[model samples]
Target: MMTSAKREAAPANGRRLILFGAFDRHNFGDLLLARCAAAGARTDIVFTGLAARDLRKFGGFHTLALADAIAAFGSEDADFVHVGGELLTTTAWEAAVMLQSPSDTARIVALHDRSPDARTAWARSVLGTTRRIPYIVAQDDLPTRWRTHFRAVGGVAFDTLPGAERNEILRALRTATTLSVRDRTTFDALRHAGVDTDLLPDPAAATPALFGATIGQRGQGGEIAALRSRMRSWAAVQLAAEWGDDATLDRVAGSLLATSAASGTGIVLYRAGLAPWHDDLDTLRRLADRLGAQRPVAILESAHVLDIFALLAEACAYVGTSLHGWIVAHAFKVPARCLVRGPADKAARYTDTWCDVPRQWRTPEDGPLFPETISG
Candidate 1:
């Protein structure tokens, strides 16, 4: 565990650090990554994302636009840290759409879906970057005095990226003073492209060690408190909205029902991310409705990042599609099972690289089941 003194220590010679990532949105993992990076920093850190966003209400930082951040601090001698996430394969289109409000996402997506030229223009306009990979900044993007570091970032789908985009990412990574990836698949792909990177666990793995006390405090009140009081024991459940179809929900509900019956644990559904294309509260509510009040099922609709962490920290086990949720559960030594569409999923890749636990892959006949490792 890092002591407060160590964590609060200023950077050597008082150099500033620009912590950059896709944290401008409400995604749980991105916000958590920003928190982890900030907690571990030994310098004055400025959070930067694609757009200027004040997400503090959700326990995220007041992020400045990356372009604005560069203009404001680029001239200074600062260290640029690309805070860890699945940033490598994120296209400008995806990042642009995810950065929008949920209500506006559909309209923007629809307007640009059929027009490749319009989509490209809109993505570049929204992200304010012309780089093929907008999220991964190249050395030339910053001042000559600035140094770059890519820390524990993941790109499980990097191999599938277009040749031009892959080259663009490689060019940026080559200039990093320190580069590390979070999974073997990503590391292997980068190595195949002649970019050497250290393979480290996702930074979120250290969540419990760094913020367990804070998370515990958060659970003592509000929705977390009510849920804990209502159910003696519960499993934290989360899944992306894409899994909300009738057949899929039915399978998932059946599995949850069986697990609840067998272990006498209630179900607590939480949204891992509220950004466009992320988890949906309505999807979770639909799942709750399917559970049919037979077992104690509660939907945690809070968008505050710590609330999600608190829910996970207090749970006996976790079953979710969110890799960060599984990672946090593992950090707390709480048994967890990640639900994935297939073995190629990012969650599967991450767990395969760093975990001994088996992840559940969704099948037509059966949804994800509770890992047998979770004893009643």
Candidate 2:
């Protein structure tokens, strides 16, 4: 675990720690990061996100809007911790769009798409920031008395951003009281930019150690209970909406069909996030349709974060495009493989940085799904 002397001193000074990240949405990794940060903090903590959202139904915190949370602290001493995630490359427009309800996302996206001025106006209206990278707040955005800390955050594609945006992110990191990155790719990029940072594993790697029992208990009830009762043995499968095209789905379905035939285990498909660009029920349904009832393939429609954890925890193996799915599965010592677009993909970069085991990455063009090592 990564500990800081600043965090240790905060309790003595009675400074409340405002834990901030992408927790306002339903992404499994972001929600898990919030829980892990809260569980590990020594002082009182408040959860803040891009928007004020109550996600308790999904096993997440009642998150406050970034601006509101900062204002509430006023001149009081506090520690602002950017909890964790691939937060660096997210633009203002992307963040704002993800926070909107699925129904409102299409109209908002269309409006933003039509005009650059409209995009800026809508992003500013929703996020309360004009900065291109709104998620990583600079010192000017906070109270003068508050301190900043960033813990094990990932930004694998930081090098691909424009110079001005890169400088913006650098300015934010330079002001942090303590800064650490989750992947070597991000660390090397920042280092080349003249900013030094500690390299650490993603915070979610500690999920099994911190919340193993709680997660297991959560599985004993609700939708997870029903799933557990139904599948005697299964492999947890998940993919983002970006891979939902017919051709990609056919490739994935073919690989999965062969795996099911060989192992005689059922397939359980789950959504890792409900944000606009994350997972899609329709996409998962499409993949399921291609599977065509060859075996007991089931779609887990639950959005609860721990339920997602429980499903992965109880699986015979995990195969997906989600980094967190691989992280959680690896945490529980479950055999797993992560699907990636290429070597530069975030999941691929992360595994390259920290995974000691040989990686078996299945891309869209790959024929076989799981390697011989990942078996039921």
Residues 1-376, model 2: lDDT tens digits? 1233222122335888888899999888889899988885775678998889999999899999987887788578888888889988888888999998888888888777889788878899988777898879887678998888888888999989989889899989888888888898998898888788888899888888898999889989987788778777888999899999898899889888888878878899999998888999999999999999787899998888888989989888889999999999988888888999888888988888888875656677665777555455
Q: In candidate 1, what are the lDDT values of residues 65-130, reduced to their tens digit? A: 977887888779888888899988899888889988899988998899999799999998887788
> Which 10-residue span in candidate 2 carries the lowest summed lDDT?
1-10
Candidate 2 stretches greater than 4 Å from native = 1-13
Instruction: State, as a TM-score between 0 and 1, how close model 2 is to the true structure.
Output: 0.94
Q: Alpha carbon lDDT of residue 67, candidate 1?
A: 76
Off by over 4 Å in 1: 1-11, 40-43, 358-368
lDDT of each: 0.85, 0.85
